[model samples]
Target: MSTFAVHLSYPSSPPGMKLVGKRYVSANAQQEGLPLVFTHYTGAHKELREPAIQKLFDLHSKRPTPAIRKAWAFAGNHGEAGVVNAGSLKSETNGLLHSLLSTLPPSSVSYRAIMFVEPSLITREMRLKHKAERRIAPRSCAR
Candidate 1:
């Protein structure tokens, strides 16, 4: 039997639905660093249609026994909007992540926080990294 790592991310919480865009990242896939399962909806339009997305969250929230809870969370940033829109896909994804994580057993990995950011947005932000942690940076460079 193989052990998998679980990670969750989401966009919004419907009135009856708890987790919405939760992702289940894996722990084994070397290429993944830590295996992850996260949901990504292109825009708000997708979030409005919550049935399929919420079901996805419910699926991940279930502990499969063999898997270990590594880490999980929700996070986002606003570009033009002055106030961060909690209703945005990015924000809702984070909310679902929180719900999925609540089901995990207490462990060291559970204590660590997960970062949720738009890949494109991060590129634009140009976050600086120190020499030692360069390996953590994404493979592609801007130029």
Candidate 2:
């Protein structure tokens, strides 16, 4: 379940779909008023047949699990997703981390992969620290 409520135009949608996760943001106001998902798709998708995009959106919108919402995100500056685009990314990430922490786990290492589209944030310090850790080098400077 998500942290916010959703109201789809379809009257046939299951009532359970309207229920969002408990709004346990713990005082982070930015977490409020954000749409449940953002598909930041590239313009290349425009090449697809017109109905294809809408169909895909409809398919995914039917399943509002947090992980699916995160995966459905694409990379375009226009369309349904706007500033809530970045906010959705941050909020979903917070949810993932919190879920992990809440679960007691066996002693082991955890890994995460992120995609960053910028390069200016990549610095020598980041490179050195990463190398010192002896882990695989990251390919992006995503924050």
Candidate 3:
């Protein structure tokens, strides 16, 4: 059986690197290797959020033609005590989505899930579309 794991590492990535530093679970179940996904989400950027979300939608809509899977946004605005929020930035989102799309499973040719800490574009109405968890931390937790 394949094991599924998702690691959360907040405030670990440095600036200008382009990734949010969220740890990825290993499908091997016996391997100790993990990877990071980058996003461009910043809680404060209302302008960028809409476009980012739209871009994500476009990316995911294409199922048979190169799709996106899991993703993470880099910390855009760091809160007190080294707490940064990177859940909707373009640079970070693009990076993370690109990585996931490149490594999609053969059986599943398209995106099935999108993970983010906080997505400004996701309105309250959209939340009801799926079984998503919304909160102060990790904004968009949809699958």
Candidate 4:
């Protein structure tokens, strides 16, 4: 099977959601905080190959996963505007290399904290890298 390293982040929580003991809870008793509602931002290294990732994103963007759809519905039900918006996928070739190099003994890869940023804040190079990554094969580059 193909293995991929991915980073995901949520820029903001729903309006009524509150951080309670490291978990988000909704003001509404019937609904809980949708912490897994991370349809907004995602990043992947070249380990997954660019075209495959793009195709996956295209397919899912048109028809989001069940979890994403549920998050959208939850946002709408709570009248939380702007919680669900079009997000971007980044290609972090340099970041990926850095992450790999930062790895210590006994572990093949290093874990980096997720970064939360506004969709508008994403750089042009990141977008361009995303495009370029999609064209290259996942295993073609140095691992």
Candidate 5:
């Protein structure tokens, strides 16, 4: 499990670098090129959060993909804190799904039981479909 932070910034913009005395310092000071807006995962559940960040980065790098744009719009609609909570819930749900799929066969009754008990996975799937539909729909179309 992991926690991640996402930022929206231009791809070409240099990372938050500063000249401290004679030394230049940045988060990835030794590495060249600007860091992606959504970079690094930390916390006890960071492993879970990392993939979400990676997915967002993969979608948003160079230009904002539809999913990225939709996420941004979601944040805009819900507020920054709401987005953070949503991301955390999504990550946790993914971790649960991964654990379930990796440890249990599809035919296992326990697996089916857990899936039935946890509505988070179902909600996440519905949200994914909603995002996909939003992405496919033209911008001018009202939802």
Candidate 6:
């Protein structure tokens, strides 16, 4: 998640450098950037990750094509902290989500804190939609 945040928080890569395979690789990364990029996404859902796949393309909209959009692997998704749905509010997660939200602005960092501290094979896509929001951290955040 931090990788995704850092990617959005900064400017694009330099010429000849491309954001492939989660790192700055040569634009000619033919090896990693074959006809398709095969990656793995892990999370909570136990079904085929269609939305998760779509969200992957949504997040990395650098120069996407229909074929390029056809992802093969690599994803790690979760909910806004412990709040996966309205039902989550009925459990102890209720108090936790409220407290965490009160303290941190809605961001992946905060979400990661409440849950998703480890990598998993599960893939769960939250039905809630979060419009893309990219920004520079405030100076106070630097300290």
Which scores greater on TM-score, model 1 or model 4?
1
Off by over 4 Å in 4: 1-69, 73-118, 134-143
Per-residue accuracy of model 6 over 1-143 as CA lDDT, tens digit each: 11121111113222222122232222223333223332333343212334554554454454443222233322222232112333433432223221323555556632111212223532344212221221232222322
lDDT of 2 by residue, 31-95 (tens): 22322222222332212222433443354456542222211223222232223234444434222
Q: Write the per-residue lDDT of candidate 4 for residues 1-143, one digit (tens) a residue.
A: 12222222222432333211111222221232122222222332122233433344344445433211111111211111222221211211122122322443365544322334344567888878787664574335313
- Give the runs in model 2 whose Cα sits over 4 Å from its true position: 1-70, 78-120, 134-143
> Could you tell me which residue pairs clash in candidate 4?
50-133, 50-134, 51-134
Best by lDDT: 3
TM-score of each: 0.24, 0.17, 0.24, 0.21, 0.22, 0.18
After TM-score superposition, what is the CA distance of residue 6 in candidate 3 from its true location, in Å?
22
Candidate 1 structure lDDT = 0.34
List model 5 lDDT by residue over 14-88, tens digit each. 233111111112221223332222111122222233454445545345443332222111121123323434544
Between prediction 2 and prediction 4, the one with superior lDDT is 2
* Residue pairs with clashing backbones, model 2: 2-21, 39-74, 40-74, 40-75, 40-76, 41-74, 41-75
Which of 2 and 5 is ahead in TM-score?
5
Q: List the residue pairs that clash in candidate 5.
A: 1-45, 1-46, 2-45, 2-46
Q: Number of clashes in every candidate structure? A: 21, 7, 17, 3, 4, 11
Worst 10 residues of 6 by lDDT: 1-10
- Report the C-alpha lDDT of model 3 over 67-130, residue by residue, as the tens digit: 3333333333332112333433434533332344345545543443445555467777787764
> How many clashing residue pairs are found in candidate 5?
4
The lDDT values for all models are 0.34, 0.31, 0.36, 0.29, 0.31, 0.29
Q: Residue 19 of model 5: what lDDT?
A: 11
